[model samples]
Target: MSVLVVGASAAGLTTAEALRRKGFRGALTVLGAEYHPPYDRPPLSKQFLSGDWDEARTRLRPDNLLAALDAEFVLGDPAVSLSDHTVHTAAGRSLTADHVVIATGLQPRRLPGPPLEGVHVLRTLDDAAALRNALAADKRGGVVVVGDGVLGAEIAATVRKLGIAVTLAGPQAALMEAQLGAVVGGLLGELHAAEGVELRLGAAVEQLEGVDGWVSGVRLVGGEVLPADVVVVALGAVPATGWLEGSGLTLENGVVCDEYCRAADGVYAAGDVARWRHEDRLVRLENRTNATEQALCVAANIMGEHQPYRPVPYFWTDQFGTKLQVHGRPSADLTIAEGTIGERFVAHYRDAGRIVGVLGWNAPKQTRTHRMHLISGEGHR
Candidate 1:
């Protein structure tokens, strides 16, 4: 059997690897929109943007391991459309396979305006490099990061570490309040403030003030202007599904799929591009770990193993030497299961009095143990 995986990033590469490891000795082709090999993306905001790690260090696998897989890699050619089992690329190549996997990932959302210099969105390696260059070029001007999500917070932390002034602006009451609740998110805001990052939360960004087609500052809705030479827009992303418009797939937010990650007969999707049925709801996860985990489930289903992909959503973030790990969905009903909120704690999140999530702030070991409470249906003691 021949398999065609459209996307050369972590999800696509991991799907190919999982297939080979599961005894699939078939013709495999991994099509990529980018020229570079599969690389880790989380570090793009921290280590890569800060210049602490080189390009080579971000690679997910070495040359030898990739060669061992023996999968044909078609790089620099993006899939433009899909018709049945055949995929048409931007370079006008039609590739057919018994099974086609869509893992095209996401595209960064940009502000409504013409493209301006010194303004960036951190989604690709090139985006990180461009933002890094813009920051290193001048330490004199401040940087206003629009968006208080995980990406925006990390970028602000990294930019501040580079001795550049950073102002984090967003509509949320606290940093990542929508994800981690007000208490933990407020603590995170305190952490950033302690590190010299100016927090301008609870306000929406109105527009970008620019000079000579270069970003000069970010204007807020309430007439507050945060002046800066560099601006990073981490306003989140949408699934890269423009090419799949006429492909007959139910595209709403992402590629809709069954519980098994199957979009149709002999066709599937993984990673951020996949919004599959899990339990009673359709869910789409946009984290590196989910990319690999969902790809593995897709590969198993492709091999006729027939299993539903139900995963407890988990993600982590690192900034200012502190690592925060979140297991399951964090809700408002939070309880301090261990340690103190001031420093090193594992907080439990409940929904209608049932333990549903766990948040570890510099408490990895305790978090792992508390995670079992979420998995085994046990209440937090």
Candidate 2:
């Protein structure tokens, strides 16, 4: 039997590797759109952009490990269309496989702004490299980040470390107010401010002004302009599901899948592209941990070992010399801080008297304990 997997990122590579490890000896093919091999993305905004790690050092698997899978790799060619049993690539190649895995993750959401030379987005290795080079070229210029999301925050922090004046502007009153809440968001804003990043919270970009065909500054809705030599638009990413339009799978925000990540018979999807059945709702998680975990489950189910793919949603972010990790569901109301809220602490989020989430600020060991509570609760459900 032949198995075909589209996308060669964390989800795609992990699913293909898991299939081989789980004893799938049939023909396997992995298709990727990028010219480079699959690499870790979390570091793109951190160490890679900071020049602490090189491109070759970011590969997910070594050459020897990838060779063990013995799968045919079609790099730099994306699967443009898919039928029930057939996959068509942009390079004029049609592949028919016994089973098809759709792991196409996400694409950066482009903003409706002026096209300037210095305006960039971070979603690929090439993107990080370009932004990094731009920052290094003008070490003293101001960098305006258009989004206050985690990616934008990280980029702002890292760029600040490179001696560039960074202006982080977003519509929210605080950075990542939806995910971190007011308390944590305030703390993070303080951290960024302490690091010399100019915060333009509650500010909306009206238009991007350019100087000589290159981005020069960002004009706010109130006619205030933040001088900038470069602009990083980290608005967010959308599920890369445009290619699956003609496919028979249900696409509601993401590929609607069952609890097993199965979109249809003999077909499956994992990662940010798959919004599987969650507790009382369908949710799509776009984190690295979920990608690996869900892909393994997809691999298992593809080999006839059926198991529900319900994850307790975990995510982490590193910014301004502080690392924060979160597990479980977060609600608007968190009762109190289970631990201290200083350099190290575990904030407990409760919903209706039950702890729904645990957030750790530099406390890994303590955070793991509360994370187990979530794991046990999930197992019982």
Best by TM-score: 1
Q: Write candidate 2's Cα lDDT for 143-169 as tens digits.
A: 899999899999999998988888999
Instruction: Give me the candidate number with maximum lDDT.
Output: 1
lDDT of 1 by residue, 1-381 (tens): 999999999999999999999999999999999999998899999999999999999999999999999999999999999999999999999999999999999999999987788888999898888888888886566899999999999999999898888999999999999788999999999999999999999999999988899888899998989998888999999999999998999999999999999999999999999999987789999898899999999999989999888888889999898899998888999999999896999999998889888999999999999899877866432
Assess candidate 1 and give its lDDT: 0.93
CA lDDT of every candidate: 0.93, 0.88
Can you give the lDDT of residue 155 in candidate 1?
95
Candidate 1, clashing residue pairs?
A: none
Q: Against the correct fold, how does model 2 do in TM-score?
A: 0.97
TM-scores of all predicted structures: 0.98, 0.97
Error (Å) of candidate 1 at residue 23 is: 0.5
